[model samples]
Target: MNRVEIDGDRCKACGLCIDACNKHLLTLSSDLNAKGYHPIEIHDVEECSACALCGVICPEGSLAVYKEIKPKKGG
Candidate 1:
């Protein structure tokens, strides 16, 4: 499984990540952050491909993508 962690306090709500996401899983939050900007939120984490495009596109560096690693069965 893959996941995206967003730092709302650092996010500027520029919408660049939203445009960069191919899965359309990212969206702006209804609540405002300390910076008075609607932070980005993931609609469906399971749909994320962990392509890192959103994180790469974000100027604020608020988004972090992590890919889960599973051990081999007979290792």
Candidate 2:
């Protein structure tokens, strides 16, 4: 499964990642982080392609996307 990991403390609630995500997988949390800012989270995670657009758009560099890779049957 593909997913995004966010360092809430490092996030500034910019919402850039939310806009960058083509799959609409990002959303702002109602609660604030340690920095007193609302952080982004992966909400619609059913089909995350791990495009890294969110990470790229994140100015704070707090987002990391991970995608699971399947091994080949003949390998």
Candidate 3:
């Protein structure tokens, strides 16, 4: 399954990833991290397309997008 892994402790809560998400799946969490910042969270991971826009926009490099690769048949 395609997913985005977030390093909340490293996040600076800049909101760039939130704005960059085309599906608006990313949002600032209500809870604060060790750095006392509201890190970003995925509202619905199932909706994520692994487009990597959020990861690309994040200045802190906190987001990592992973897309599953299935082997082709009849190889």
Candidate 4:
């Protein structure tokens, strides 16, 4: 499973990460963060493809995804 961490304090709620998530796993939270902006929330961690598009698209770089590496077959 991939681990996605969202720093609410730094998030500007630009919704870039939400749209960048290919898995449709990201959404803007209804609750406000310390900066008074809605933070991005990850739906299912198990469903995360670890594509890292959200992290890359984030203008604030508030999202970080950590993916487990699997050994390639027939290596």
Winning model by lDDT? 1
Model 1 clashing-pair count: 0
| Per-residue lDDT over 1-75 for candidate 3, one digit per residue giving the tens place of the 0 to 100 score | 788999999999999998898999999999999999999999888888899999988899898999988789999
Model 4 scores a C-alpha lDDT of: 0.88
lDDT of 1 by residue, 1-75 (tens): 898999999999999999999999989999999989999999889988899999999999998999888788998
Evaluate model 1: give its TM-score.
Answer: 0.91
Whole-model lDDT for model 3 versus the true structure? 0.91
Residue 15, candidate 3: alpha-carbon lDDT: 96
User: Could you give candidate 2's per-residue lDDT for residues 1-75 as a string of tens digits?
Assistant: 887888999999989988899989888899899989988878768689999999998899998889889787997
| Runs of candidate 2 exceeding 4 Å displacement | none
- Which 10-residue window of candidate 4 scores lowest in summed lDDT? 14-23
Q: State the weakest 10-residue window (summed lDDT) of model 3.
A: 40-49
Q: Rank the candidates by TM-score, best first.
A: 1, 2, 3, 4
On TM-score, the stronger of 2 and 3 is 2
By lDDT, the candidates rank as: 1, 3, 2, 4
Each candidate: what lDDT? 0.93, 0.88, 0.91, 0.88
TM-score of each: 0.91, 0.90, 0.89, 0.88
Q: Which ten residues in a row have the lowest lDDT in candidate 1?
A: 66-75
lDDT of 3 at 70: 75
